[model samples]
Target chain A: MSGASLAIPDRLRLLRGANNEGVLAVVLLALIVAMSIANPAFFTLPTAFSILRSSIVPLIFALGVLMVIISGGIDVSFAAIAVFAAYTTVRALQSGTPDLGLIGAFALALLIGASLGVINGFLIAKFRLPTLIVTLGTQGIFKGALLTYVGSRYIADLPASMAQVSTTNLFEVSTPTGSAYLHILVVPAVLLAIGLAWVLRSTMFGRSIYAIGGDVEAARRAGIRVMRTQVAVYVIAGTMAAAGGMIYVIMGRSASPQILVGSELDIIAAVVLGGASIFGGRGSVLGTTLGVILVQVIYNSLILAGVPSAWQRTAVGVLLIIGVGIQAVASRRSSRASVIDETYQKQEVPA
Target chain B: MKLADPETKPLSRLNDSVDAGWTRLLGLGRIEGGVRRMLILVVVAFAVFAALKPSIFLSGTNLRNIALNSPEIGVIAIAMMLAMLTGGIDLSLVAMANLSAITMSTMFTAVAAGDPALAEQLFPVILLAGIAVGVLGGVINGLLISGLGITPILATLGSMQIYNGIAVAWTGGKTLYGSPSALTAIGSSTVAGIPILFYVFVLVAVAIGVVVTRTPLGLRIQLQGANPTAARYSGIASRKILLSTYVLTGLLSGIAGVLFIARNPTASADYGASYVLLVIVIAVLGGTNPNGGFATVLGVVLATLTLQIVSSGFTAMRLSAYQYAIAQGLILVAAMAFEQVRWRRRRRSRKPAVQPG
Candidate 1:
């Protein structure tokens, strides 16, 4: 009875809740605390920096995917796009007379990502073809192109400046145990995450993405150019995935078709685990960051605990099931709330 | 909205009759929306194949090759069509097929250990083992999706990983060789100017066709898939229907696995991974709408032939392996575009017919 009379301010705050990001923050804190207690070495700066380095590339792509999902679509070609981008960049460097050099290569790769994303958007939004079908076809095309372009030959030697990004670390940070560690190339990833979160929260375009996803037809009727917004979303996603791919090449020191063969599933799962709906509209970049961390943590913990690497796939499989299950439950609750709302509204109307 | 205006009613009726007649003649009325497209694709494909490879296209040997290659996929396609028809997908079919292949191959190698001739004689035994493994896999998928409230796509996806993992683990990532001769004979031997496996595929397809067209069970499944909420409200058990379809698909895929083992005489971790996309493509191309309540088995069979010819043509032409991916993608795009064109045409013609009244 008292809840029904709640203040508008309190209700709005409740409706636009802190969401899955808050859950992620709690999970991150709990993970750090538990891991630290289990192994004091876990809290050391070196270990932390190493984890950060490992997380950078995936984290970047995950942000891009988070944007796509929030805009109510999916891009399964992220890994493929990244592979192509890396291939292009490496092929550029190998010719000695580097066309775009490092910065130019990355910019071109991002442009390709965005362009391919636009193609995906055109097929899905304009043609009214199912997203799954178009993406599946595009994925095949991307993979095929990668295979044909590289033809099993990997570029081993790269320009020193480009290769040095992975190994270069900042000054050492002192730890409680009198130990010190350096930050690796992942230094940029952390900065990128913070910047992305800021833009997503404060920008007008970011708000439009949420609005479009939440109610596409309504948004369109309200004079929002749905097609353009969706196309822009895919372009951004493509660019980010391209950036992630480059980072991956830097870390791994080579680009292989098999490197991230089944990685798209992991990216999607991470986004879903972070509580993003496959149906679109509601999600957070912070939540996705945690989702990636959760996945990595699970993988890392399993390795540290001496579990076989094969079981890592099983862990992902199980996590996917659990993630979908939670989403299903959440969907049911939201629908039930709508039903209750309708009933209340009908009662408020004149007989 | 009144479809009975005097000025248009007679012409509309005539148009409806012609549409119905045309669809029935092509076997489109026997299933759902996609089946008609598949039928059209088959015509387009056969004409193209015959034109491109005239000498070999009409030859008995090539026709027999098409037959032999089909059963392994054909049976599985039947199950897959049912699953897709119900508004769900079974990504695990290929994985299940691999598992069954491994199981059968393992059983063959075990029973005939150091006795190749004896293993050759026990072909039926291997086939039974493959079918059994497939049924078991299907049961697991059905139970998980139906009994556990898991969505078909996610459930099957999870099962895909699990099945593949089990297959890999069971074989310890090693290929199983020295399969039974009887199974191989079923794959290779010709009977009455046709391949044995082809007959088996025909029988399976016809059996499934009959079940889908004539049985109450099939009717309930179609109803359930067409609208789960409506079906559930009408007292149909949607969960059971879904579970049974998954089971059916798994069982058929298992049969396909055995045929694959029989033909290849080997099983590996990578045995069925490639088939996953191909299977979906063929099923969709065959005229089985994943969200529709009906499918055309014959259309799928014809489309399979067309696709196989295209694949063989590509290989024969010495194209890069990557080209096959491009071809498949293009074909899928074309099929979808064709469906959209037909849908638009139907919508356009119907609007004018209604508006004039």
Candidate 2:
């Protein structure tokens, strides 16, 4: 096994190790400076805080998708899952369920999301279906169910307590230009990112995710519980999506069945841009966070630059192509280098 | 060899017997098993619908409605089948269609406004140009996938967005209407009470079927998809094959778009956003292997009719459109699952019958 691993060229390994985050950091810094120079107001604390605040929902979704990508699968149904979970919570609150406070609503959302995840997990793990096709089906089913059961109506009559929970400011800073506030949701979002990052770095389950993604047959031979790990990854994704949904409803003070329809692309683009490979086995919490921030910054700067909103989709599409193109080239080069190294090592061993 | 051992022989024979029983129960051996199952399903759905709405379901107008509605989807579904046959998918099909339709219709509207006589003469040109634009879209996708090495899904996904954006920007998100009567006739007119659109679909389907079964290009595509490394080592140009498949898909989808505007006489950037998933369902339901290398034009045709019947049935039954979506999703999942199970069973059955080493 050790000899097999040594087939990878050291230079390629080193480059892969530093690739995504380093490029992103430089690009992010350049964009920030450029934006600030173009519009001095963009550099202000209030603007920065607003950008951070708007990123919370997508950040949560991105973290979940990052885990899915790292585990060698993809889930576009998370947005639908989030919508279902949020609608359930709002409907529960609107029903005037006594003692079903914000915490209870949140718990309910998580439970519903987890159950849906379990269905996705069972089908993909047991039957060995492609995650993309399976999720595409489930996305339709979930969205259809939402439409049939909940209609297209928005839920606005939420408990005042829920609104307060979302609006509760963690801290505020007053500057000469203006004041900036941080919502309470940011704390949980940051903590979740940090905790997941730690898990990926230090835990056996986390290591197994990488192994499985790197090579399923090898991972199985190494005694990794592939099915269990896959299910766990999806469940975690579902739970996180639910949390994101809760935050969305709280922030907006309403829930619509159509919420987050077609926004999964944005989440996926952010994760891919941050350094995560869609093929799996490569990603990090830190990289994903930066990806989320970078996507937000690009979106913000485009708006500030007075570009049409429709062009924003074009920009995101272009960014996705470029980012994925670079990753593909890098991976291809690395794989080719490894092949050459393997042959060279074999020749040297005989000599 | 393991077969020389008397003790192992009984176990192997018993395993074979059990596998044979399961395979028999599942109807797993035949290549046409999927078609048989789909035919049965179609029969059952037709019977149920006919029973519920005896007058309307069996009426000529309703039948024509099904015929008219299915070809647009049928044309695109065939293209989707081609893409899937190459072990790639074109998520940008609908986007390509809309973009090309917008371009053609926009050109038509402008030309007609300035010179109606020129517009009449250029109608065919405009239609051809729309299809050419679709081919251009496919060229872009082929370049992205084969030239740049992006995965088909991601490549097409990105292109889907880009094409959609361009369409939106081009028309400012407005609908382009009023194509010439000659153009509309291709979509709406019928000879001897049969829709020309249906005839076009059948003709295209038969042509594609013949080409796929008989032509060298089709053979190369099948070979590339079945095993690209083997195909490449055998001197086939895998990249060129892939590029051609996508281009073919774009051409078909472009034709579908033209027909769409011919019938509706309107082209919009946002038109047929829902068809993306629906076409995938139809292709998969038709037994075009999602992983590629195996497809049937006949299967696609049958599947289109089956779905069209169900859709029209649902409409006559007054069920909501969401119900149709639900049915499509369920059908896609069930069809794929059935294929997976059949594959696994076939693999298992093949194992024991192999000569022991």
Candidate 3:
């Protein structure tokens, strides 16, 4: 090959190594601009707030899954966990028991989610089974149990306080078309993302997660409690899934048995789009947050563009493939570069 | 050069040991092991179902119904077995099947609407087109996975959505009817009291089993899944093997789709959505290794029958449809967990023995 032609792969490899998030951001910006151009109303403040509000639950889920994925595992059953948690909490609230405060309800939901996560973690870590398959089985069991016990009822009769919490806004801004309000849950969602980002960046446990994901045997040799860390990762993922479900119920004013079923694809696509490698050991809360936003924006924009909602799943699927394709190409190039570097260093060392 | 060769010898030996360890850990070469376990489960399920509702569960008509229903999911499960044997999964099988059925049914309906006699003559052509849709779907999946290097799960997941979306868009989520008599006969008609669909399932399963076990291509697939790097070094075309496995799955799925429409006499974009999980469950329960390298077609066939019995048994016992999902999930988890335990025990027992020469 000519020198100039060879330089093209090198340049592409360089781009892949360093600019994954940068590329995603560019794509997001282009999509926003395109949507704004197609529908002038898209860039309005109200629509922006609406998109953010809608993104909160999925963002929560994406953050959880991002961590799990980075730790070399996948959790498809989070949707089921969310359903079970949401259903139980909604049922308890609707049963007219002595008012357990909002905290109690949140605790109940989180506890259930974490417990389910523990079961998943234990099975996967102990049995050394594939995470995808384990979670796939659990996903079915959880949904089936819910259906059997709960009978597919929609729990719309939430406590007055919980319903009020949904409408309770932190701030309201008037726009040309309408006013927009940031709901109360938005603060917690943002805080969770920030807290998780901090933990992933700063904590010893978080570093161990990355280490294990990068090379499990190495991590084990280095005395990282691989099993414990894995269980913790699933627990965190489960908790976030539960939190997302609760948010969905509170903000949407209804909890149904079917809530979040088959929505794992959206959550996963968002994380992957945000620059998380499905193979693990790479991802961030910030990237996942942006990914969630980009996905929601695309989804909302599609509806605004009058594309039927059925096509949205197709769009997400395409996005997933593209995102994964980019990651695969980048990682392959980087590995190849390192291999070449190792060979070059060996040659120079003998001289 | 002699010194370097000596240095590399130990490393190669270590690699060989690691390979052996994995095969032994998963009991990969023990094809008969899964078959025996599945056979026991099938017998137990039959006994339990018969005990619960002898009149309905053991009835000739109910037995025939189970046989009829088993093929649709069984055929897909066989396809899934091939995919899993190569250490990949095709989540798009159900979607491909539905899309193919929809395409075939739509074409048939349009033709019949225009000229009933001509539609009758072209019925076989329409069925072939449906099978073609499945093959096309498979080829697309194979390219995305083998060519682009996307993981099987993500690649098929995307294809599943795309294929399903196309079906939905084409049908506007409406069910299409009017299958030709000949097409329906393939599903509903029987020879010597045995359903035609069962024969098709058996034929596909046996053909695949023979190809995978008795042929060089099958050996290549096993080697590729067992150790891809070694397989590559040994001159196996990894991409070609992967591509062919997915294409074969797609073809099987297409056949299943055609049979699906043949039996139901209607095609819907969303048909057999639930079978996605069911087929995976069947494949896994049948002892196909999710991590690849080892699979038994007979195991899958037995597992399919076992599941069909449990399903119709539940109906006989008047259990809610929700119970069926619960049982399926439980059985899948239990089977996998049992396999893991058995493998671990075998590994532990083998560890104490002297290394084989």
Clashes of each: 3, 0, 0
Give residue B145's lDDT in candidate 3 (0 to 100): 87
Pairs that clash in candidate 3: none
Q: Over 4 Å off in model 1, which ranges?
A: A1-47, A96-99, A149-152, A170-184, A195-202, A257-259, A329-351, B1-40, B43-65, B108-129, B352-357
Q: Give lDDT tens digits, candidate 3, residues B153-227.
A: 889988888898888878888888887878887777889888988898899988998999999999999888888
lDDT (Cα) of model 1 = 0.75
TM-score of each: 0.85, 0.90, 0.91
Q: Which portions of model 2 miss their true places by more than 4 Å?
A: A1-19, B1-31, B355-357
Q: DockQ for all models, in order? A: 0.38, 0.46, 0.46
The iRMS of the candidates, in order, is 2.0, 1.4, 1.5
The candidate maximizing lDDT is 3
Error of 2 at B233 (Å): 1.3
Summarize candidate 2's per-residue lDDT along A1-351 as a digit string, tens digits.
Answer: 354566557644543455368677778899999999999989998889888999999999999999989989989889999998889778866775774777888899999889888878887898888887788788888888878876668877667778778668889999999778988789989999999988988999999998888888899999999999999988888899989988988988888987896888779878888888778898888888988998788889998999877777777778888888887777789899999999999999978
For residue A235, model 2's alpha carbon misses the true position, in angstroms, by: 1.9
RMSD of 3: 8.2
Return whichever of 1 and 3 wins on lDDT.
Answer: 3
